[model samples]
Target chain A: MAKTRVPAIEGWFTTGDEPALVGSRGKETGSYFFPKSVAFSRNPAAPAEKLEEVALGRRGRIWSFTTNYYPPPEPYVAPDPFVPYTIVAVELPEEQMVVLGQLAEGADPAALKVGAEVELVLGTLYEDDEHEYEVWKWRPV
Target chain B: MTDVAILGVGMHPWGKWGRNFVDYGVAAAQAALADAGMEWRDIQFVSGADTIRNGYPGYVSGATFAQALGWQGAPVASSYAACASGATALNAARAQILAGLCDVALVVGADTTPKGFLAPTAGERRDDPDWLRFRLLGATNPAYFGLYARRRMELYGATPGDFARVKVKNARHGLTNPNARYRKEVTEDDVLGSPVVADPLHLLEICATSDGGAAVVIASTDFAKSRGTKAPARIAAISTVTPTYPNTVIEMPNFATDSSAGVKPPETTFRDSIAAKAYDEAGLGPDDLDVAEVYDLSTALELDWYENIGLCKAGEAEKLLNDGDTTLGGRIPVNTSGGLACFGEAVPAQALAQVCELTWQLRGEAGERQAEGAKVGLTINQGLFGHGSSVIVIR
Candidate 1:
């Protein structure tokens, strides 16, 4: 049997071959929300809809990028003997939302530029002896 | 417009003093009272900007400050809006006088931040956006600032040289500020030589977390007149606007922005909307102002505010900086108190400190950093979590 694959946060992205982020789409108005936009709609006039789950685009353009020089404060588990990592803000043309994710292994600020194309990929957040926590990461394409 | 007179303003010099926040608050409160030539007993109401990172006293700052100053049975309220905490406290005090609930109100905001990127209060709850941003994406404050900086360079042709100039200019002004945390002059070389905290922004380009306090005493115009406090600067407007819905920009503490597909976005950005509301309330335009104090959390963010505050047209901030338009003795000197770049961010106290600088300038008392003939001045800052603040003061 395959080992248990867990996400750091639930209902945010998928684990399938297609590998896409999970978001919410309003039934009344065609709007997308990442991390589930259940409560309210941006349109004040249109009543909020019963939100439905939708898959976000797999490829997007980099809106901006930066490197985290210092170790981030906790709840963020870093690799021991910490090394700096780059974060990318990607704008999905289909969803019209900018989502942030850590850059893939060996890809960082020095290699990335604004408007660069990127594809979503699964990366390890961190792991204990029992389980590996899977999180979405961005890779240069 | 409901007018509130700021009869006094004072600050506890910003630095890493390693003292309890209560001491800073009390000292600043006493200084403000003395500046107004009033007593603590005269303060009918006290509103405090809260400090969440600290212990019990931070949450109940109004009562804590009142108790520290020897309580005089004054009504108290506390506000928390991240960095806008100070401005929110000022707005609360102004509201009391304008509502006829109090003749005079004292506002105090103080903080002693730990050195590092400001993190959320300790907890494990995944529901907190502030914590989630840090935990999941590793989004430190500088990351967001870096994102904005990179975008600015791409869109507006702003250069690292432009960013370095802002630090140099602010440091020069900070040399004149007794209360500023870092007062030494820094050249562009100094900025370029600093280590990179975020891409396109160096260590010297960013403000640090500091320990400081600031206070203001506001009274109704009638009360000031009765007390013979002549020629005082009057706060014509205080704007604490929330972001309009469909906020498309990706700001701190949020993993994603509102998708534009749901609704047509507003014409103005959330930051620009803050100044528009203040300008409307004060019946003044940007051109009417003599000086401005903007939140310069990062050097690039300062240039961004130049457009947001209507100092120049969009994508034209670089020109303004290069032309010496935002420096002292230029057209509309910005950050005349050296801004967060020099003072370092004391969180709750930072916004109030901006007003203190403006107050001194309006009084022609800002000895070295004074904007010549400063008749009208504005202070603006956007705290994390959608808190926007702007206050207009005129002599």
Candidate 2:
């Protein structure tokens, strides 16, 4: 039986066929935030503006990328016999912000380059007996 | 701004001694006091940098160090600014002296870090950006360093070999630094051959965490003169500014850069503005600096700092390195006391350690690592969450 898919962290991103990161936009300034800033406006110039929930751009160009050779310390859950993964910083043209995400599984680090286009996708972050933990990942296009 | 004299600077050396943090702090404080030719009771104020790894004592480090040195009831202040903690503490003491609240102050920072990647506080807090980055993306400090290094490669044609050369130069400089943790000379090949911890950055290219402490004694110029000590190194400025709105560059422990979609990005990037503020207050520019001690968190980061601190233009750091302009005997020698490349990072202690190195150089007491006739010096570093650290010292 296939395990139930659950977001590794809830409300940060949607888990679906065409997933998009959940973010917030300042009502007054139009600035964007990932993982949604619910409390206040992060923009110093537009402080006190209300933030509205919005979906960030699903696609962006790679600003830079790196591959982590060693497993990071917990609360990072590593797979048994941990596999190395590439992390990418993607610049969203609409948001004008660079957001970091793990490159989707099986994407070759060598195949990636600065300015390469990538889209958001839900990937298995880890798994348990009854559930598959999913998190937002970047897939090179 | 009025200048605060650096009466003396001292360090307990950088190494993994595995001792209590207090031991290192006391030793460094004693050394600084002795170097200043003053008694412990003479200090009118104490400023200490906090270490998160240790418990309550580390939190109230100012009183901890004071009590360890037999408290004289001096007013105490403790600051925590991640890696910029030392500079924060130093600034606190400088403020008191400049405000005439005290004639003399002791500033100290020490840490005993764990082995391996510095982890976030043990918890499952989704709100903390530091924890979220590690839990969600598994991005370590070196990972950020790797990203910047790769960006350099793509934009300015920086090579792995160029990064290795930075380690090679720093290792050679560390050979003459008694306080340096890694004093052995290294070659470019040795650095390049080290195991890769992060792409485009080798294990040798990254700084390790170590147990260390550093301290400085600062006083008003009038106080220095009263003590019959003339011409001491004067702190011309200390810049502890935060990032302006729309900090476009991605910083550590953060999953995203601030969106510039709303406000126009600042003319100066966050890192560039760190030292710019210091230069503005000091009435000096990069050309005025005879020597510098910048945080080389990673070899490639040092190259980035060359441009960040205005030593050279962006994309021209590699050329500056190739020209030997930043080496020990060159124009505007940088990291002359080996920097974090050799000292490793004691977080709270590292920034003050930079000031200690500059004070030694300005006093003409630095032995083999001395930058000759170095009358002006600058130190710059950035801490997590927008803590900018920069200090300018002149003799």
Candidate 3:
């Protein structure tokens, strides 16, 4: 039997055929915020304005990328035998913002380059006996 | 703003002593007081830079230090601005002096950090971006450094060898400094040969976390003159500005950069504006700098700072380093105290340590690492969130 798949952090991103990050947009200023700033706008010009939840662009260009050779400290959960992973900062053109995520599993770090296009996908951040923890990751387009 | 004189500066050597942070802070404060030729009672204000690691005393650091030094009922203020805490404390003290509330002030900062990478406050804090980045993406401090270093490589053709050269230069600079933690010289081969912590950033290319403390004694110029202390190193300006709206760059502990889709980005990038504000306040420019101390969290970040602080134009830092313009004997020597590369990072104490080095250089007290005829100096550093710090000192 397969283990249950669940989001590592709930409501931050959608897991499906076309995964997209959940972001918030300022009604007045049109500024976008990731992880959805529901309380108020972050922009000083429109601080009191209401923010609306919106889906961010699913695809972006790789602004820059790097591979981590060592495991990060807690609250980062590493596997028993740790495997290195590549992290990417992707520039979403429509949003004019840069968002960070780990490169999807099986994606080649050597093939990654600045300005290369990548799309959002769901991948395992870590797993336990009962469940597979999912997170938003980037994959080469 | 009127200038305030830095009458004395002192520091406890940077090392992992695994002792109570108060020991370091009290030692540095006493040293600064003695160096200023003033007793504890002379301080009208005590401003402490806070450390989050040491529990309650670290939180109320100003009162903590004051009580330890036998409180004279001096007014106290404690500041916490991540790595810029020290400068924040200094800014608070300078404010009181300029407001005529205090004639003399003691600014102190100390830290007792953990062994490995600086981690976020312990908890299941999903809302906090600092924790979110660590838990969700497992992005450590070196991850951000790796991103910036790779960007530099992609943007300016900066090589791993170029990054290695930075450690080599700083190690050589650290050799002559007594207070530096890593006092031995390091070759480029040594740096390149070290383990790779982050891609494009070797283990040696990154700074370490160490326990340390630093302090400064400052006073109104009039008060300094009355004390017969003439021609002290004066703080010409202190820039504690925040990032303007639409900060496009991805800073530490943040998962995303601000969206420029709605609002256009600021005219000056956040990092550039840090020193620009100080230059504007001091009525000075990059050309006026005789020496400098910049936050070198990673070797490649130093190259980024060369452009950020206007030492050279963007993409020209590698060329500047190649020309030996930022070395100890160069035209405008930077990080003559060996910077964070030598001292490692002690959070609250790091920024004040930069100021301490500048004061020593401006006063011609820096013996071996001294930049000859140094009269003007600048220090620039940034902390997490939106805290920006830059201070200019002139003799």
Candidate 4:
């Protein structure tokens, strides 16, 4: 039997034709938070209210990016004989916030630059016998 | 309220020695005690910077160090705030002095870090943003530095050569300081030739991690007066401010910045607010600073701090460096102790090391790299987790 698919960290993204990242919108103050504010509102001016979960915009421009030369320590699952990968900070227009995610596989330093348009896609981080963990990655559009 | 006077300052020279942190803390504490012309028993209070990597004893470093020093039963407090742990320790001691709880308090910070990149503790806790940045994005600390360096290049036209120059300048100062980890001077070619850790930042331009210890003896002004010292370097002001809402800039250990949809960001940036608060309390401005020791985690970050500390206008830090205004014998020398570029960062001990430099400069004790006629000095450091601190010292 094939492994089950699950969000690497739940409540961050979903699977669809054009899956979008998840966030929360403050009904009182129009504030938006990624990973959806579950504890409390960060805004000082806004009173406490139930935040509505919303699917974030699919597209954004790369604000900045860098390729890591070394593998990050565990808790992070890197492929055997680890290959270096790039990370991009993407700025969503509607949210007016920069979200950081890994650039898609095969992406390198020469390809990405500031202000380049990027879109999100769900990718596998690592897989076990029972489940294939997934995370959001950025691809040059 | 009465003022707090730093009766003495001591540091076990920063290095990568494999000795235990407790020994370093004790050595620095003994040195400070001797310098203050007092015994350990005379200290009425003790405050220490907490090192998280160590076990539970590390969490209560104050009592740990106190017991190690033969336990006179002094009130103890331990504080932890990433790199600003030392400054937090200093403030804890200062509050005790100002409140008349202790006539004299001893502050100490020490750390023994690993060889390479400071990684998050081994865990599977997903809620921590620090761990998520690494596990999810593979964004190392230098990755953020690279982003900032690239942004500076695009926005301010800063070149790789300009970044290299900062290393050259600091390494030169490092040669004059006996305690620095890297004493060999580096040139612009050295910085450029170094392997790229992340996009715009080279390995040479980023600071390393090391083991070190620093301690200071602080007392009430009345106590200092009774000790027959008419003048001692005073901690005029300390700013321990948090970031304002709508934190636009993505800081270290954070996956993303706050969304700016509902509330507008504050005009005073996180770094700016720290310096402003210190200045307001000290009744002084940037013009009054004769010397400054800033956290230079990377060469580009140093330039950002140049503007953040009000040494220059927005986007004018490169010009300040080009004009020789920030070097020794200039308008105001920064990082006179060679900064983290040479000393490397020792976490809890780093901020206290900055204060030690300012204390030496204020007292005319800084030997070869001392800024001339330095009467007032300031030290600024920003740690992870929204902890920013600035300490102003005056003679």
Candidate 5:
């Protein structure tokens, strides 16, 4: 049932049983990954996981966040003059892990709080003339 | 370790240089060499506080300055300990001179920081502690400063006005300092009006990062006398120490503080510990200090430093500051050279610049800001990670 046709962390996670993987030498250890793509785990020697398998889907509570009013250094161009956005840590329950992602548009930091619920959505970070990179974004739920 | 004398010290005016950091470093080094009545080739070693070089060799400033000063073939060492980099460089140069490894050594630090919040390195690497803190907590450096500022207000009964008073006092002193970044007086009302960067801290309450440099020429006592330098400022002690385990309090850019699982933290704070070690090595108490240069990253932190350096009993810093004990003409002058608050943060170079100010104060050459007949001076700086540095200079 855990497979759900989604990508799973091979040799790490299995349904109804704790995920086990070979760690340091021949020793074996249990590891847990959340949203599988966001690789939050207790053990260092865990197998790569898929995002769909472990994802605590969509909207989560805002753990904490800060607005980058100031321009970031290098490679990141602001949306013209000042493109301010909140970098929020959202707590996902399915994996019981907190994930950090940029806040979506129309989300005002002044209205945000410690436990504010947020929704994860696919977003574009920035696009130069040559290429584009997909980024994860969060907005008020 | 061998005793070393601060034979010469110099600095360039700190501000928006809009130029390369190497140029400022070379200028400061030239001034120091000139002040020492020695040529660049006369120096035996060079140590610089390293800065992140954007693809330039100057990132490792020791070699950068060595090459800038025309390859003196002297031993060079580069150190980075956040704000404490300057003092760490001083300690390294002093060690070389004391070990008899080199008779004369030069310590220099400089940085041309890009404006605004210093962001973490670009990449998806989660293994780096610096990166993890930013990604997980969104805890900027100013956030930690705000935490300390808030704690000060809660514990010490310090008012927001009191923090502004530190800026006023330091800016007033900076008016006499040609090299200070801000040489004008500031008012408490002005501080109140400044926009908030963090909760309790206004724009003016926090120090701005700048591009600047400072250099000091340190030599063995014998070397100083031979060079016709008399009554040189002597470095009596240096503390380059780290904290004990179980550091519960959250430092800057850290997502979660220590869990306190293994062992208890020290009774004294990390800052206080650095000062205590310096005093022990120098065989002097806080009372012996005529002047001091402290890391005043924020106005509130300056008051905290007074307590950490044993200027007064804990919680008495506010009272002492209110009573003008830390002003230029007060009992124990702190930041007489206008500190980081007035001088601006130059990262790795700031701590070395603190000692330079101390050397001047100890030699009774601080002009208008001179602590009357000052005999002993101290400078303190705390770096990121687990590093800190303090130096006691006497004449």
Candidate 6:
């Protein structure tokens, strides 16, 4: 089996620990991706969406993406701080929704185009004293 | 409604000072009070635009600024509506004056922004869209801007050159502004030469974050006359309006747009919806505008504002821009104070700063960047997550 993806942020994954399976309560679009991720909740019900998992087959084109030139934020220490990684917005064919997530390791976002192929993967985000919020990520398929 | 006059307007310029936001705000507030010939204690009310300070303060901007100004026991109100924070503060001041609650009120906004991408404050919270975008998509504000600019290019046939010219025009205008952050002129070649942070948009096409503060003193018409002022540039309207839902549009700091599942979206774009509310309230149309100040977070967004503000019809921003209509001395000059492009992004203070520019232009005191014979002016700004602001001013 493919090496299990490790969570970038701990406890955000639904399946085996995978950096690809970061999970969060999907917002209004009703897919497995955050419509807009925020540090605080806009609605009272948002806290419940954290760490919930649904189907992941949704796929979409890369709307736009960027590569990490620096360490993303605190609590996320990679083996290499400057390692190149991609983030993509994949349009899900069945759900007709788009999910945003970090690209699989070694994927280059700079070379990707707007309509590039993309799919969802579970991800691992960092965790600390507070919480470990993981969710879905996008990668070129 | 009671008429209100601007007693004073002051700023801490627009640049990175590497200082705390409170310092900038206090400086601007003091200057405005001095200009208005009043002490800080004389002010009856204080309004502040909310910001993300070093410590988590929620959005208690009014109390924050009041504390910075040394707490004069005045009624404090903190207003948060994303980019419209400044204007919302202004509105609060106007309402206080018109309601006969207070004769003079101070409206201020200031921010000492964090370097690089503006992210949600720490701690894992999957519920907030602003934070989720960073954690999941790693999407920066520029990415949304790039997406919009690309969409503009695809839909409106706006070329990268067109986007570059916006920077050139705004920079030329900024070159004359004493308070603008970037005063040097930028050429189209300079824009093209810069590396593309997002495809179709070069580095020069984006705005940088800055530490800045702006404050305005608003008093009633009688209060201004009593203070020996004959005629002050007066505010006609402050539009702190929200968008009509289902918004059904993809905007900054949001991953997906309104589902369009529940209800029909309005015919006007979200930005335009803001201006429409202001125009309706002020009983003024776009044709009557002498000049305009818009949020140019990026080169393309400025063009987007042009259409939204009714300066031109949809998809014709490039035509107006190419004709030199948006430059100083054009039929309706825009961003005569160099706009966010030259001023950099100062968040809460930016929207109020737009009105400050208008007050100066309407008074014909803009010097090098003056819009000749300007009578009526408008400032349009929108904040992330659905906070929209537009203000109309007339001399």
- Give the number of the best model, judged by DockQ: 2
Instruction: Report the lDDT tens digits of candidate 5 across residue range B245-291.
Output: 43545565543333222233458777788899999999999999999
Q: Estimate each model's TM-score.
A: 0.97, 0.99, 0.99, 0.97, 0.77, 0.83
* lDDT for each candidate structure: 0.90, 0.93, 0.93, 0.87, 0.74, 0.75
lDDT of 2 by residue, B1-395 (tens): 58999998899988999999999998998899999998999899999999999989999999999999997899999999999999999999999999999999999999999999999988778889899899999999999999999999999999999999999889888898888999988989899899999999999999999999999999999999998997999999999999998999999888999999999999999999999999999999999999999889999999999999999999999999889999999998889988888999999999999999999999999899888899999999999989999999999
Q: Is candidate 2 or candidate 6 better by TM-score?
A: 2
Q: Which is the leading candidate under lDDT? A: 2
RMSD of 1: 1.5
Question: For model 2, how does the per-residue alpha-carbon lDDT over A1-120 read when each residue is reduced to its tens digit?
Answer: 989989999899876678999999999999998768999988888799999999899999999999999999999899979888889999999999999999998888999989989999
Model 3, C-alpha of B236: deviation from truth (Å):
0.5
| Candidate 3: segments with Cα more than 4 A from true spot | none
List ranges where model 2 is wrong by over 4 Å: none
Off by over 4 Å in 4: A1-5, A127-132
Q: Poorest 10 consecutive residues of model 2 chain B by lDDT?
A: B121-130
Single out the weakest 10-residue window by summed lDDT for candidate 4 chain B. Answer: B1-10
lDDT of 6 by residue, B158-275 (tens): 9999999999999999897878889998889999998876556778888888889999999999988888986788888777766664454566677665433223446886888888
Point out the higher-scoring one by DockQ: 4 or 5: 4
Docking class of 5: incorrect
In candidate 1 chain A, what residue range of length 10 has the lowest lDDT sum?
A: A41-50
| Candidate 6: Cα lDDT at A108 | 63
lDDT of 3 by residue, B159-249 (tens): 9989999888888888888889999888889999999998999999999999999999999999999999979999999999999989999
Give the B-chain TM-score of model 6.
0.96
